[model samples]
Target: METLRNWSSLCGYFVFIFLTTVSKDACFSEGSACEAPTSPECFTKNAIETVYNCEWSMNRTDGIVTFDLYFNSKTKFEVFNKTWHTIPEEKLIQRREVFIWVEAHVGNSSCSSPRRSVVLRDIVKYDAPQITSMSWSNSSLSLMWEAPEKHPALTEVWLRGDGHPAELRKETFTRINTDQVTVANLSQHSTHWVQIRQRSTQVKSPLWSNWSPWVKVPAELAHAPEVNVTTKRLNGTREVTLTWKLRSHAAAAAAGVTYQLSDTQSSLGCPCARTEKRRHYLF
Candidate 1:
């Protein structure tokens, strides 16, 4: 009876050891399967610099997991626990397709994300351009904006005329290769709202940037104002009074209009003008 009891106790100890080892191995295997990161996203913001920025998302797992970015046939970037990596311009050949993938490693476990293939030049997104100046000539409006880079670019312009809803009235898109663009046939006698957007022209496939802020362009004066003049003699000097009346049209007498009175003979005098140059502001 004593021998049987001892044999039973030894078998129980072995069973407990086997069960504990199996449980630990199973938990470790489960944790290793979760180390793979999500698929990566990669893009180049502009054609000028041509630097590729890549990122991936990963779930929280046990222990610290380091990442390695692999691209372009065995070229490896040691991300070192970072989710993002910037591939420099010097490491790539332009206008060619590149394959990219990321691998996560922790202790003896390793996993990889899904692979992605893309052309570096085809995935470009430029910064939004800004409108610098606006001018009017007859019935045309000229708009000038700052270029994000020295390279050529394609532009899209949106114009909204007065008395119309927020919808676009005119759309002008072209490969202007210049920062200045002129839109003809626009109404100079009516107000307008203008907005602009741009994309890289040097690339085969490029993305357009977000539209810039809307710019308010007041209506330009279409005709000269009607003036009434009265002359009076005081102290052997002639005093002249000039008064002008704007037309009844709302566009012709729009707010923020500046009326200037000037004389080529240098006869007008005011605090705002020099003695040699005669100029006066009539509001």
Candidate 2:
């Protein structure tokens, strides 16, 4: 009875070992005898039955990288060439660290050798900023913009305003850190063309994004319009022709000024008497 119990225990131990070995083998079978090449240096080069070279490219719009594998033979090429997973949207925008790997199958069979992992780390580029709102008042222009999707290590903005009369003046503000800027001392009653651009310090290279389209801002706010009114009697009618001239066309248009006319009644006792009749006209 003692010998039989010992034999049973030994058999159970052997069964456990066999099961573990089978599980590991099953996992290792996928990339059996397959290894990565060293040309790119992003992946590991190993001594195995088959070797492959890998190449990758970034898709800025989709925010993903497509990896392709080149094998010596057609059979290996068909099995290992596949796109990796799509990069996370937040990770791409934030320019965070990312890792990628691929499994190369050594033989024709899908499961053959242990899978080898390769990794690459990169910093994604950020998109350009966009202007959201703008306003001008009292010869001052205020602009607001939306920052890039990815938070840049350091952001620099550029603003430019071109005044009318070509030679009058051109103003530019550079290396501004904030998303909003107010430009003062602009010429009133004139149209000013404005544009903006931005760059990020997170990137290794020094590159500025494309400038935003030009926008026009008429500097006519806070200034009262100067208007001259004159009246002349017609040949033989009670109607009188009134003509007016505005010193500043831009200011008058922006202010939406309106004119009102009233005729006063004259009497013996009262030299001038106010009349209830009045006419309003928009200029």
Candidate 3:
């Protein structure tokens, strides 16, 4: 009888603890608004808005993490619309980088405390930049990612690829709309994998940090795409209807018939030249 009573009490205590933990998590944002640094009114009364979400690794060996939230603006303060997750380093495949970014939409006003951007990758915990978008054009690959979590500040970005003697492409970010970095004049008809890296070290070799995923790009000098021609006899004489397949969308989709072929090639830059796109016709 005594043991049963003790067990019941322990169960009740555990329930209380679980509820307490959940309640605390639910109240962190509200408490931050009431506490310090964060002005709850940044969403309503000011032109400058601030938003922040933090993610951390309990084990140092874990990989870096990304806390994602649908963002329409660069920075903003909201009652809700925040999320977080941590990724251990072990989960990362090959040699790639993981980034964390927070955006803000300019409020009607400014913040009371001007927050400075910090290097979050090992240098500063919870201080990673935002990845806006990634793409490539011909030999030049471009990266447009968000900058600074809070107040306006100067920033820089770099890129890594398998070019001869692999080098880093750097660019500086000022009070700008976005962070843009492009490494151009690359070889054409060739595909190279790339990743994005950044450093806020104004005007110096701050640090050629690690790279993100390998974003591939076509070779520089862009080959005139590729052309594959085919013809068919008009069910009779030499009156053959000719149609050539080219590497252009307009060429593929002409008249009313759309012709598209997926080549089973190693993409374009795939090391295996055996890679190819299958041909298709819709007349």
Q: Against the true structure, whose lDDT is highest?
A: 1
Cα deviation at 26, candidate 2, in Å, is 52
Clashes of 3: 30
Ranking by lDDT: 1, 2, 3
Number of clashing residue pairs, candidate 2? 6
- Per-candidate TM vs. native? 0.48, 0.31, 0.29
Q: Judge candidate 1 against the unseen true structure and give its global Cα lDDT, from 0 to 1.
A: 0.68
> What TM-score, to 2 decimals, does candidate 1 have?
0.48
Residue range 56-85, candidate 2, lDDT tens digits: 322122222222332222212232234322
lDDT against the true structure, each candidate: 0.68, 0.41, 0.35
Clash pairs (backbone) in predicted model 1: none
Error of 3 at 185 (Å): 3.5
* Segments of candidate 2 deviating more than 4 angstroms: 1-126, 149-177, 221-283
lDDT of 1 at 221: 52
Q: How accurate locally is residue 5 in candidate 2, as Cα lDDT from 0 to 100?
A: 22
- lDDT score for residue 91 of model 3: 30
What candidate 1 gets wrong by more than 4 Å, as runs, is 1-47, 53-87, 91-95, 100-116, 122-124, 149-152, 162-165, 175-177, 220-283
lDDT of 3 by residue, 85-197 (tens): 33332332212222223322122211122233332232322134444443446566455665533333344555444564266666555544426666566555554544555
TM-score of candidate 2 against the unseen true structure: 0.31
C-alpha positional error of residue 125 in candidate 2 after TM-score superposition, expressed in Å: 5.2
